[model samples]
Target: MLLHRLRAPAVLLALALTALPAVAQTPMEDPLDARDARRVDRMEKVVRELRDIVFKAQRTGAPVVVQPADTDARMAELGARISDLEQSLTRINGSLETTGHELELAKRENEALKVQVKDLTDRLAVAEKAVAPPEPPEPPAEEPARAATPQEAFTAARQLMLSGDYAAAEQAFAAYVQDYPEGPRIAEARYWWGKTLTVRNAHAQAATAYIGAIRGWPQTSWAPDAVVELARSLVALKKPTDACQALAELPKRYPKAPTTVTNRAAATRTQAKCAA
Candidate 1:
């Protein structure tokens, strides 16, 4: 720094030396000339003080620039390199930021894809259920089967009668008659079938069935019972005369009827007001 300050004094001294020849060529110097010489002396004294300042400043550790032009060129080159490095760092930072943004976008897209896949899976499950065939219903539990024998069928029908299920008993006896005409209890089935119909206030149908039982199976034990019930059914049809006629024919049709059957016919004939 002090060496640069010394340059101004050196330039002034060179200018002063160059002007000394012109000064010597002039006439006896005027007051202006003496003033010029005094001014030159003051400039020389200032130049000397600048040299002493330069020496003192150098000892005080002030850096002196020896070659200003070369130092300026080197500093310019260093500044340019630093600026280039800063620009490169800026570009690198920008590139890094761009990459980070791209990665984030990809991550978001991946997450969205996963969500879509999950939703599709759920919908597929629901769709499968919607289109799937319904399960078949379970079969009902089977009841214990009844015996299919003639005696069993007749007994079942008689049980209905004992239980006071006249309609069911009539249906049962009719089914028995259809399935087994030569059943062991066929005669009883026909007779009881008529009795069931009569109990249900079906006198006209009962009369037809009773007559069929007596004529169809006259040799059977239930034939005489059919004849007795037939007369009773006729009385129920509001035909006392027809009932009396049926009772009178019973002795001729079934002479071998049991005492109980004969007694029952007599009681029915009395109730029906038959001619003595």
Candidate 2:
């Protein structure tokens, strides 16, 4: 309202000035003519009167009157400008608030993504460990235990012989004979033991193993094989006569031997040399 009051007179003055003509052709006149002198005097008196009135008004603190519409219009324009500026401020604040919220949400999402990545990485490591093959444990430097009983040892020795582990089988059978001279499979063990020795080219040892099988268990199932092996071993030992005699007796003693005829003929040939 105070701004309106200040602007009203200025607006009225502007309108009055616009209504007046800015340019005019003046009547020619002498500089010091009586008619011009009278006109100049009249103008000077009018200006003096107006100056006096303005001076008096300044002295007095009287309120200046102005056109109501012009005053009100200028006030309305100012109010509108102020309103526009306030609305612009409100829009800027709202935008700032929205941007802040979006930034906060982005931060939270980033933190959650980091946690998910860490969890996935941890699970991946565990899975790799679970699936990766393990290295085999080193074998003990020493050999394992032997069979306890003589029969057990002999049986083990026979299995080893079948598997062609001749050296191990021979050791097993020797241990058996030393531990239990009268074990049930002694003759069988000795027979195979002798064959194992022959396979290893231990001729003397083979003869000894076969002789032990024949003398200790003459009635055993292994007796025929043992006797034949004994005769062959004796032949290798350069005792052909003893070998032939043993081979000749093999069939009579054990007629069920698998190669009775062949053994008898070979023994007969050797016995002929012995007789000569």
Candidate 3:
């Protein structure tokens, strides 16, 4: 509206300033001529007035320019620009929101993929273990040299018997005898073998072991004990007469035996009622 008010005056000022220059350009006249003196004076006064107007306009700012007959159109054009800018901003915001949703979905998918990959890796490890061959059970670790001497071997077998590991004791005693046929401990081994058989109620086998012990090592420390075990096994086999004969032989066979052995033999003889 201020532009409207200033436009007409600025146009009038510019027109007057330009027209004065042409009006002052009348055919060249003598400075001393009185006939055109008033015309020259009027022209000079008008020129001076126009010059003053130009100076005043220049002293102020440049004129606010407005095209003619385009007020409504210009206002409509500005309104359209503002509406377009608003629509562009709305579209940009909508696009940003959509992008945010897409990014969140991508993150969730990535996490799911990571979980799947981890599960697959774990399953693959287990599968590899299952399909792969066993480690050969570590080769049994070499099992250090068992017994350095015959005595050691015999003692080991006897310890098994004392500990009531009868099965292992039997195997161990048999192994001892086979490994050391002429060892000093062989007689003791045979005696213990007989005792072990009797305890297992294998009276027939016990009798064989006792007889073998007596025949193979009759002068050894275990002979008296072997005879006692033989009698017991024969009694268990329902041969009480054979058992009594075995007991009767113990005193004469092991005459130098300990008093305890001698007493046990005498008692066993009384139990069996052997002929004197």
Candidate 4:
């Protein structure tokens, strides 16, 4: 009978030890509670003393002293605490999930706002360009005056040449030539026009002008000089044979020509590399 009593207490202790791991695995809201820890320590000490008593009775044929454990109420309270802790943890996890979802929605809204801002900016630029104004039209040009007579035109052209306005002189002389092909001073005008062309380095045009000036060998005061100028223009044109021929005719055509004219002709022959 005594053995039966001891074995009953041993079986109860074994069941209690097996239940401990399941209780320990339960979540706690506050595992560091001093009151709860002290209650657990008292229960463990009672179980250890009971185990030692049972072992001594079995070994020495003595009566076992088993202490009644006061742990049932405390274990029930701990279970309630663990249940509350699990509910609290569930609430906290749900709150965190809700916050993450709100952040995701906020990010999507922010991105949409950025796209809207860019679209609005482009629309504003187009609107500004559409509302801007057009430019004004240009004015008409003035016409140059006409000279009343051919002499007046010719005198104006000669004055332009004398004033060193070569560009205006060239245009004026060209206009005079067109206006008065049969003018009294046409040959002299051609000669002066040739002088302007030579200043402009238009040697070929100058040669043509000089030829026209001395046509039929007019024997005018400027005629001998015009022949010398013609030979000079031919030499500049790289026609040495034509230049020498023009120079050869100078003495026979204008024998009483000025010393200046004769001297220029002699120099022109040397420039042309003329023989004897």
By TM-score, the best candidate is 4
- Tell me how far the alpha carbon of residue 83 in candidate 2 is from the true structure, in angstroms, after superposition: 99
Please write out the lDDT profile of model 4 over residues 96-215, one tens digit for every residue: 999999999999999999999999999999998998786564332222244678788778878888888776776777777778899888888888888888897899999999999989
Each model's C-alpha lDDT?
A: 0.79, 0.71, 0.76, 0.81
Where does the lowest 10-residue lDDT sum fall in candidate 4?
137-146
Relative to the unseen true structure, what is the C-alpha lDDT of residue 74 in candidate 1, on a scale of 0 to 100? 95
Residue range 152-230, candidate 3, lDDT tens digits = 9888887888898776777777777778989987767877887777777988988987887898447877788788878
Candidate with the larger TM-score of 2 and 3? 2
Q: Give the root-mean-square deviation of each candidate in angstroms.
A: 24.0, 22.2, 20.6, 17.8
lDDT sort, best first: 4, 1, 3, 2
Which regions of candidate 3 are displaced past 4 Å? 1-149
What would the TM-scores of all predictions be?
A: 0.42, 0.43, 0.42, 0.47
Comparing candidate 3 with candidate 4, which one achieves the higher lDDT? 4
Task: Report lDDT (Cα) of residue 199, candidate 1.
Answer: 81
RMSD in Å for model 4: 17.8
> What residue pairs are clashing in model 4?
none
Q: Write the per-residue lDDT of candidate 2 for residues 183-261, one digit (tens) a residue.
A: 8877777788788789868889999888878874477666876776777777777888887777767668877776764
Alpha-carbon error at 231 in model 1, in Å?
A: 0.5
Model 4 has an lDDT value of: 0.81
TM-score: the better of candidates 1 and 2: 2
Candidate 4 ranges beyond 4 A from true positions = 1-146
Residue-level error in angstroms, candidate 1, position 71? 99
